[model samples]
Target: MDKFPIHIAFNFVFLRKKITGIRVHAIELFRALEEQKETKYIFHVITTKEGADILNEHGIRANGGIKVHIIASSFEKETDRLKLQLFSLNNTLKQNRIALLHCFDYLTPLQRPAYAKIIATIHDLIWLENPNTYSLPKRLFKKVFFSHSIRKADALIAVSKTSKESLIQHYGHGYDQKTTVIPNGLRNTFLTIKKQGNPERLIKGEYIIAVGRYLPHKNYERLIKAYAHCNTKAQLVIAGSDMDKSVDLQRLAQELGLNDKLLLLKNPTDAELISLISHASLFVMPSLTEGFGLPLLEAMSLSTPVLCSDIPVLKEVCENAALYFNPLSIEDMAAKITYALNSSPILQKLIENGHERVQAFSWENSAKQVMNLYDDLLLNY
Candidate 1:
């Protein structure tokens, strides 16, 4: 029992709990870490009341190795943020005697106690890569804060090699040495596939499925156009959260004369998503950019064939388990989808490959990597 408490701060996602990824990553990571409790850990999670409430909504709370510290002020307000900087954040860190801190989602408080070492996860530089992601002022604000998080944190955690390269490309000043690549992972449930999935016939017949939030960079528009051009008879079903209602995918499908062919599913349950993916003719991810493609793994874990963009991050995650297409070209995407559907031998190989690929990732494995990082930081200290 080489146990000695090491305090680390985490909890950054202000999740609408939109999809499993956001909540699963934020809480499940810690849960995974806690399960690997042979190594000493006392997670001093500093989050807003709302953030704490969000965790509560998911039916989790403080456990033996997990300690929740509520920040009295709101993270969303400007004045309250300043107050967090000048008083709330510093006091919280000092009072906890936090030796190490882990910041998630590029959200970091600039102020910290002198003894506290910081580690921040660079999820994705999406705002910078994706145009029209934010207004000029908001972009400027992100630039100011994100740069600080990059420069200030003692160790940076990039979810993929692409993200690490992007960080260096933007903030190149020998920052790469301190940055470590630790990929996000799926829960254990994904690893074990149960055949009983589609209970309600929530979606009748076979469909090609895509799951992600409705973001411009996700390239849903191109996906829709590709499906319209696609020769396959299977319907195109895009399942995202209710938040995507603003994007009005229905209108795009209607314009493409795919109103009958395209189905938009809002906030499907875990069982439903698994059923949808497991039962799909193919699972497509047409994102222009991604930090890491967890959905690809989810789709794969269910023995579903995957056809996704040839982008670096997705490539890094999927390797040879899936088919690839140019996300920007509707013609290529359509051709790939149609070709994938008709190619029985290739699809069978993909399903077999998917079963093998998913075994490489798990929450427990991710936790062990993080614990190793924490142990190294302590030994060096």
Candidate 2:
């Protein structure tokens, strides 16, 4: 029998701004899938002009068997943009004969072609888990739309087991049956790129690094306070996109008398980030909650000792590879940072374990599992 043509359509309409975890997951996963010679599936990406431009900027071009479809739309208003994408997506999927539609972001189109199976990847349930991070209106919108999208999906992929459990707890036990845990993987660049010197000179001397957007869940203020309490000369480098929260963090740093010690790099490029993490004394993830901590793996791949919050998902991701600190306790965080910086034995052990832990996660493996899931779903139909 002739092999079936499995044309997978990935919806990237939600990616309008700077690159985030969700956008990275989609791009890296697609790239991995493209490299799979065993599975002859034609990949089609549906993204906005801005998203397409960003891909192009990263040298992610459509060639080989992969194709890119740009959807021109206005992003002035959230609701209006979503509406435009939904209407346009329905037409595009039909015209392109999309066999399966994968929504990289949590939400999916309310109306889709009947012939295509829809798969939605849920990175986190921040709105439901930590309501304080989002406004009431935005939370309500996500609750409604996300619930609908999950219910409509033919299958759901969770980035971590914590996320899958969260879905079951909030969305009910039915989700447990359909949801599969396929953790996110590092981009090939992160795995193969050589450690380059800090070209920007962002760090003066020994420094600790943390990466995340300026969100309350990221707990940057607490991380700063902990750093101030630690007696190390190492600087605290917080690198992420500057949302409005950065101003508040700067104010907090001043209040804590850590203005001189805290360095905020707003949205560093991938190469710059690699350089920063590669040379760091330690990489810390102070997030209160995460679906999966990708940076921990990135830091580990770089052979940087890891220190992170003692949260369930972090524990699941880091396993025995990192030194844990109580996220809510400044003293605990401080002590852990001090130990990680001063103790060479602990640091060396962590680096060794980190490299071993990181080997289990690869985009190639992740893509193969996703492709197998697609095949299983198609066979059932």
Candidate 3:
């Protein structure tokens, strides 16, 4: 007798919004699954029209093995839109007889078919950690919807052990058996990109690089202050999308009289970002918290030394391959930056160790693990 292929569905609704780390993960994982020949599975992606367009732009829709289900819905109101999506998703799963659904953005159809199992990936609980950062309505939505989705999920994937612990700590116990720590993987493009020499227009001289969204938890203000106190003449290059916190960081730089030494590139293209990381003297992650610190891994893959905040998740992600600093203490952060830049031997070791550490993660491996989990879940049926 021949073995049957497993049919699974993936939620790609996140593509409707601006591209973020979560969206990237969904895309990369899908691509990896498509490339895997060892697994005989039929993959179905449930996405909005916009999501389909984005996938088409990336040539992902060209794969004959993957089926794309486009659900049309208006986005005028969040609640109504979710309702429409849930209805469409439930119908899609039942119509196609999909045995499993993987939600990459910590959300799922409110009403799932009895035959379909859910696996949700919780990237972070930032709003739960700091409610003040979000609006009251947003917080309420997250509290209600996220809690419902998580409870309904048959299994969960946490990007890091720290993220898994946070989930249980804030949401109560009994999640250990259901949750798996699967770190996000870097794109092969970042690993293969040739390091470009500094473009005088992009940066004046040797620069320290930082990349992330302009969010309060990112701690850009503290990083700017610490960079000012450093003895080196290297410019501080911060590349990320500008959000509500952008003005505050810009004002802080101006107030410190270091505007000339600070470079802010908002929403850089992937090629530009890779080039920047490839040539940087060091890549720093000043965020007070991170789900997995994907950028640190990206830097490591590109042979760039990393300096990140002394947070549990950062430590878990970088191991001893990265230099750490107190995110809250400007003095400590400055000292660590200076030490990293000045100590050639330590920097060399970090670069080598980072390369070795990054070998442990790859999209292909992560996809295999996910496929195995699907197999385990479907075996019961």
C-alpha TM-scores of all predictions? 0.90, 0.94, 0.92
- Choose the strongest candidate by TM-score: 2
Instruction: State the lDDT of candidate 3 residue by residue for 1-381, as single tens digits.
Output: 124566688887657555578878888887887777345668888877777888886667835578888776335566655665456688888888888899887878888778789999989988887666678998888888889888899999999899999999988888889898887998766755634433223555799999988877888889999999998889899998764447777788899998888888888877888778878999999988778878888899888899999989999888989999999999999999999999999999999999999888899899888878887888865
Put down candidate 1 lDDT per residue, 79-169, tens digits, no spaces: 4654454345667778877778776667577678888888878878887898575577777878888888777888888878899998988
TM-score of 1: 0.90
- Which 10 consecutive residues of model 1 have the lowest summed lDDT? 191-200
By lDDT, highest first, what's the ranking?
A: 2, 3, 1
| Best model per lDDT | 2
Clash pairs, model 3 backbone: none
Better of 1 and 3 by TM-score: 3
Order candidates by TM-score, high to low: 2, 3, 1
Better of 1 and 3 by lDDT: 3
lDDT of 1: 0.78
Tens-place lDDT per residue, model 2, 20-49, is 888789889877876773455778878878
* Cα shift from native, residue 151, model 2 (Å): 0.6
lDDT (CA) per prediction: 0.78, 0.85, 0.83
